[model samples]
Target: MVNEPSNSANGGARRPWITTVAILLVVLLAVGAYLKLRPRRIRISVVQPALQAVSSSITTNGKIEPIHSFEAHAPLAVTVKKVLIKEGDRVKAGQLLLVLDDSRARSDLALARTRLKTAQAGYSALLAGGSQQQLLVRQADRQKAITDRDAAQRQLSSLERLQQRGAASPDEVAAARDRFSRAQADLAQLDSQVRYSPQDLARSKAEIADAEANIAVAQETIRNSNIRAPFDGTVYYLPARLGAFVNAGELLLQEADLSQMQVRAFVDEPELGRLAVGETTKITWDALPGRTWQGTVTTVPSTVVNRGSRVVGEVLCKFDNSDRLLLPNLNVSVTIIANSKDNALTVPREAVREDAGHSFLYVLQGNRLHRREIKLGISNLTRVEILSGISQNDIIAVHSFSPAPFSDGVEVKIVENPS
Candidate 1:
């Protein structure tokens, strides 16, 4: 009994040691696992949401064109005889710019005049009673007819007297009366031929008028041989060369009043909907580096077209070019301000992301990151407007270079924090 009590006491002591050792082992294991499983720090760049003005704009390529321009063309085929102005010469309205050889035009005018004169002469003769020779001939014919008729009447009377005296037959008296009647009819026919009928007079007058119209056209052509400036402008282009034969309606020169210029902005089709008339625009030219010009959207494109490799809509913009430094047909760049908001929460566009068609971003909370779904209002190429999710002071990941990339509950270290 004594030995059993001693053994029980010893066993109880031993049980306490075993329990304490097992607890220590469990603690050590737990500590090792925790050290192994702890999240690693990732190097990344972060930025906080800011409160500033945000704008939604469209930037695209454009070309400069003259809003006020004119192209001169030859009106007739003629050899250029003189070129009074050179390319890039300043000219005024009604100034003589060129002259064409008028030999052909003059010959044409002479022929037209001759035809007109001849037609008028014939027309005038037809208008007068008749030619003197024709009148004299007609009068002579009438007198002869009168004489013949009188002689016939006298013969008829003698015949009739003879008949009455029983020395002529009744048939002879009838023949004498018929001869007198025939002589009177011939005189009447000759008189009718001497006068002009209304139809004949109308035909002659129309011929004369048609000839005169031709003369007028020829005269106008001769006048047009001299090319004159229709407006005050700079002759930027002059294709008129001395002794060069040019056809009618051929381009002679081009001019424009360079007081103002236009820029044709070609916005991508996807970005075209944001364009509106009267919108403020900024323009730049590659040739003139570090310079910008201001303008307004004067015209919005009604349709889209394919230009080069892009599908774009051409928007017209007008600007003040009073200095005349900007030439026509120069390529330029255009930036159109579509929408803007002031005192709004804004963030870098690079920080904002999309998840399943929903706007999202990785926001830093303490040492860990949390995926946040956000709502946006307006955005430009560089910055975006954050509407609902992020606060002004919240830090969001802009870029990451660590092997362990961004994810929920992942620890991160900010290599750069640009507030």
Candidate 2:
């Protein structure tokens, strides 16, 4: 048989202090009522998808370069005698930019002229009759030959008559005829060699032509010594100064027409395949803030190359820089408008997340969140396009960087806006 305690003993064992126990029980009941009457709290906001304009652009770095440029060089060894055009001076085509020491060229030209004069005189003498002294000697020889022939003829006639009269021998008569024949032969020789021949004329003319070519070359060299602008442009580089000695083919100056410019933008090799001509480009220079220049894609990249530390493809952009604000080799920022659209359904970029090559969004369904994958289209910096898996009125969650992010299916209060 089990022994049982009395009622008074049981009561005493159960309660350390009945009055204190009653007080604690009442406090707990009060706390339970207060908790049931209060509302849950959350720090988040919900917004429906918006139908707005969306576009995308490719931003990159580029440099400005002149379209037309000319570099002048010395044609022969020369000293810089004068510098007429300074750096940054605008000049017209054919304007004299500088002058090299032309003394050597001038002296060479004088010598060429003297040679030309000599050649011309020789050519003229060949074309005209023989020279004065030569003509005088030929004429005197012809007259002497004529007189000797006449005397020989008279002697021959006398000898013939003497032979006929039987007072002279046949041998004497034959000697007189031979003398006459010799005189006649001498006169004929003088006549045949009298004046200019065709061969002489041709040789003298060829020498004249050679001398004229030399004179023309010397004049051209002298003209080249005076450096002149090849086109209307601004002188940007001047390496030659007064009294500076420069050798042939050495750089003297550089000038360019800054009205038309090219913006060379280097793009990553991976992104080069998407580039195409006729794309619009916007340019900005750090040196001149708040100013923008516009251009169009003139050429697509043909090959990839290593530029600095990156393997990139270089693109050419053409711009009408008539204002002369853009300069050569100036680093600038470029933004290309690859594609754009108006009145497209879009969402804030922050609400989109990427997972396994697909984008997702957390939707505010009821008091909890739902995870849904979405299809995207053209996206700009601030907005993203939602093509499917969502509607215009669907509420999406937005996560902030400084706060503790929310998880899917978490209970949340509908705070239309929480700042």
Candidate 3:
């Protein structure tokens, strides 16, 4: 009777309710503990100022170029009969690089020589006193003509006097007048012969000189058919072979003076001011790794090249680390040291961010990130030169954790071992 009374006194209904309430409380507490204690995995990189060394430099893309590269082309139209060199063959100045058929050139030269010889003979004859036989014939003809004209003049004068005095018949006077007119024409023609003699000689000489000039030009064309190297260089590419036809100024071979060479590199505008002539540079070619060649800035182009980036200019660096192993047109990487200052305040590149053209750093203060605007100078790829807004001893945040539980006024318990 007592047990039955106890079951009815506090029924199973109340027991179930109490048990459910306790279970709910335990679940809530466990959830709160999990949220507080669970670690947050984050990706981060550390920040540190890089120390300067002898090899400390700023790297940029570069290319290997020849210092004395030149293209050999045919000087005149000709057919290639033979090529003496192949690509990668060493050549010397004035060495025969190739030979053209030159049959046409030879024919041209022969024709020109024949014309020149004829001109020379004529010129020689002109230089030699006039031919004796021709001179004698002209002189004799002139003298005889003059004699006949004088006789005719005398007869005409007589005829005129007779006509005036009426002592001669009309028919006789007319005959004498006709003879005088014919003689006068002959005398005038004779005088013209003497006047033109020197002019004829001068005309002949000019013709001879013109023919001689043509001959000289033809000879030059023939000589040009035998292609020769203009400078001591290596044959980088030879496009012509025996029996290949070539035209005037057509590319035959490409040669480069390997003894002296340079690397042509484009510098971005942001880094141009840092480059200077005589500044040493380190170069690494993609073809050759683990081997760095030394070079110096020899020249800087004055004009800005319009590439994707507003290229400040092109730089020509003289490579002193040339070996037979190095060839032309090889891609290279160049490193230049803009400047360095000992004990300078610097920070990780990620620590800085741009906002409206102003740079700022996220600094950690009492487990909270603080935004501090900074003045920037030069920067390499990894570190930025800090002009102001930061001290050497200040620890700056390389990354950020924002819009989470922490705010401007929120209290943050920085995980001692932040994952």
For residue 371, give model 3's deviation from the true position in Å: 3.1
Order by lDDT, highest first: 1, 2, 3
Any residue pairs clashing in model 1, and if so which? Answer: none
lDDT of predicted model 1: 0.86
Q: Write the per-residue lDDT of candidate 1 for residues 44-130, one digit (tens) a residue.
A: 898878889988889888888888788877768878999999998989999998888888778888888888888787777776656
- What lDDT would each prediction earn against the true structure? 0.86, 0.85, 0.73
* Weakest lDDT window of 10 consecutive positions for candidate 2: 399-408
Model 2 lDDT vs. the true structure?
0.85
Best candidate, lDDT-wise?
A: 1
For all predicted structures, in order, the TM-scores are: 0.69, 0.64, 0.63
Error of 1 at 244 (Å): 3.0
Q: Give the Å error, residue 336, model 2.
A: 2.5
Per-residue lDDT value at 299 in model 2: 90
Instruction: Judge candidate 2 at residue 185 and give its lDDT.
Output: 93
Q: Rank the candidates by TM-score, best first.
A: 1, 2, 3
Question: By lDDT, is 2 or 3 better?
Answer: 2
* Tens-digit per-residue lDDT, 239-286, candidate 3: 887887778889988898876678887788776767778888778876
Clashing pairs in 2: none
